[model samples]
Target: MRLTRCSGRSCLSWLSTIALTLLAGSTLTAGIALDLQDPNSIKAAASTCAYNLLTFYTGNNTGDVPGNLPAPYYWWEAGAMFGILIDYYYYTNDSQYNDLVTQGMLWQVGPDDDYMTPNQTKTEGNDDQGFWGMAAMSAAEQKYPDPPSGKPQWLALAQAVFNDQASRWDNQYCNGGLRWQIFTFNTGYDYKNSISNGCFFNLGARLALYTGNDTYAQWAEKTFNWTQAVSLMDQNYHFYDGAHTTLNCSDINRVQWTYNAGVFLLGASVMYNYVKCSNVEESDTRTDSLLSQTNGSALWLERVEGILNASSIFFATNPPNVMYEVACEPPNTCDTDNYSFKAYLARWLVASIKYAPFIQTTVMPWVQASATAAALQCSGGTNGQMCGMKWTQGSTWDGTQGVGQQMGALSVIQANLIDQVSVPVTNKTGGTSQGNAGAGGGGGVSTSDPALSQNAITQGSRAGAGVLTCLVLISVIGCSWWMIA
Candidate 1:
């Protein structure tokens, strides 16, 4: 049966009212009903889910910041939320949120066009900045309408972020990796984590594929090697949290998160696709050497599958296919940030199918089961459509609701339409976003040089360092309890 598309706010509002009224006292729950086999059904469900998710966002209001969310949510999450919206538009072709997404993304490009806006500096980490960068990358790839002329173009924005992060690569501590925090005064400054490095690597591999730049590919290879060398990633491809540079990154934080694995999985898959699709001339030895150095297509395919297999840890054993945060969801200790991690995993997992199509048999089942489970959990809050964080609970709401919950639900449901949309576009594939090779500054690490010896730290007064230290200590203790429980 063909599902009618909910095209605008009025139509969606009327549908929501009818849904709430019909299910008010019925045995049926108030969550959106999803039909997995129907493409129109998936798109309609995603449109409704996206609408509910945007209801929490006041960033588009008259007095509020264009791209920012309210309290309890940080600036970085706003960036991530916009990225989700970009995916929503791409998957469903719903142009309703395009202007909002464009405004939010461009407003936070900071003074230098990197995502280091002064508003988030005190709390901004490398991973934080990288999320915004990834959003810009998505805009370019999805061909989300470009910003008006003279503004920072999507591709250049992504490149600027990559260049800035490449400059901050710290060889002084962990051999060569981005720290968890961008500024020295931040609490996690002494720590080197997977998400930060993963985001950098993810961006590099994508930029390489987008622009056909060997430099981006070279840096991507370096970052992937650094992660494994530091033992953050084991031989089987299980990614750990991170460790303090003070300990020389030897003592690993063994707790794993979905985003960590998801980020690297997409990067590896992109690298695999990039190499397999390269039609370089026989005479270009430098390009040939880069491809050979990455072990050509065989190694990347292995890494992608290895990471996917290891990701089974995030799913339930008895029920068998629903995804959750293995580190925190069991104990109900998922923080605001942890709640959003699964969305990326779900988003990236479906996305990897485009680059590595062989994984579809393995990936789509998980996505289908999880999306089904996720839709049923959206029976919370006054509206009766707000999503809860735990999908493993099935139809029973976990008694929680937030932007993260909604984002997670929207991502997986929309992901069911992955096969219906086009794969990401590149310059060679008719991408229209203008590219700037030297975006942020130095144009990232040199293609010829493998060493990342640049010092990008800025000295700041450690006036609030004590407070930040206490918070970090508390967070670490909380993480321990979650893992132990």
Candidate 2:
């Protein structure tokens, strides 16, 4: 079958009309009606949902960058949208957005081939870079089409990101963990967050599974230990936000976000599955130790279960099985970043089901119920199908719309078809992307003087630095105005 190649505003307009045309007859007071059990019906719903989400993107327009979203949406989110699109293609086998996805993924690889694009350097956090890295990792895992011969390959790009982040494993703060922001000038540099460390762990476990490298697995283990040691992740597997180094990371931020839990959950699940699938020989003690360690697969399985059990907070008891962001959804205080957090949670939860099949019984009910609730909330906006942030509101529109809300809805709705597709493939299991063990070795931030702040400069140079900093802040604040307004 020939796939339709789509690009720019014309194609986006055409795709946006797809759901409206297909679902016009099935509309209810809630929104587009979806058949939860039918794969084809789910696919159609996903198509429309994805198209509506794409409407918020202006990056494909003439003057804008290919992989970026306009003001009010940060650069990290555009990376996430591409990851969702990658999953969209993997689940539905739709090539309609393949070109766009490829363009977006490759466009921001930055000068060093890591995700540290100069434009975003001022505000780029380790978590921000990790999100983009995970997108490239997803592309490699999904066996998405490779770039042209001269450009970076999918697996190599993921490896590059992993190697770069591994270099930033700071020892200066509370044992060892990555700082939230990459550059010290950024506000959150002194903070050590779960999402940043969790993303590194998540990427490491997947890379280990894909490449059969014990080094990646070892790093995953170390990261998990560090997170737990710092109390960012408690004994109950409840992942917290972060802790400031100024207090020696002793005072933990108890705020729980779905994405943080989701990140660690998927990483633990991947390690559990990896241990179960490993083929280490008993005679090779070193290899056996690497594969099992002290806790072995049992520890990871326990972690996987503990995380899922604790995640019950995100689901609404009133609705019985529907999912909601407990931290922000109830108070209606989710900022632009908070708005997109549930999408990653939903995305990882369904994915964890694939790695740990036993979770299917527990996960499917939430997936099915939440997908329907999310679809019902898509009844708002000018097009009559725009998704709202609060799915727990049921048919009530909640009077809001944006890329995050659309992404959250699209992610959950498309996730219903997860059972129909193949699980993520590894290099040993028919993955075709090329590998690079040393991709970003020389490009990451320096670890020699961890105490040295990038913001610390001479008074003579402060004028120039202040001017540049102001420009970046102005740009960021200008972009943020629309979202807060």
**Scored by CA lDDT, what does every candidate get?**
0.80, 0.78
**Pairs clashing in candidate 1?**
none
lDDT of 2 by residue, 407-449 (tens): 8888888898887877677765567888666677444333443
Q: Which ten residues in a row have the lowest lDDT in candidate 2?
A: 463-472
For model 1 the TM-score comes to 0.86
TM-score of each: 0.86, 0.85
Stretches of candidate 1 off by over 4 Å are 1-28, 441-485
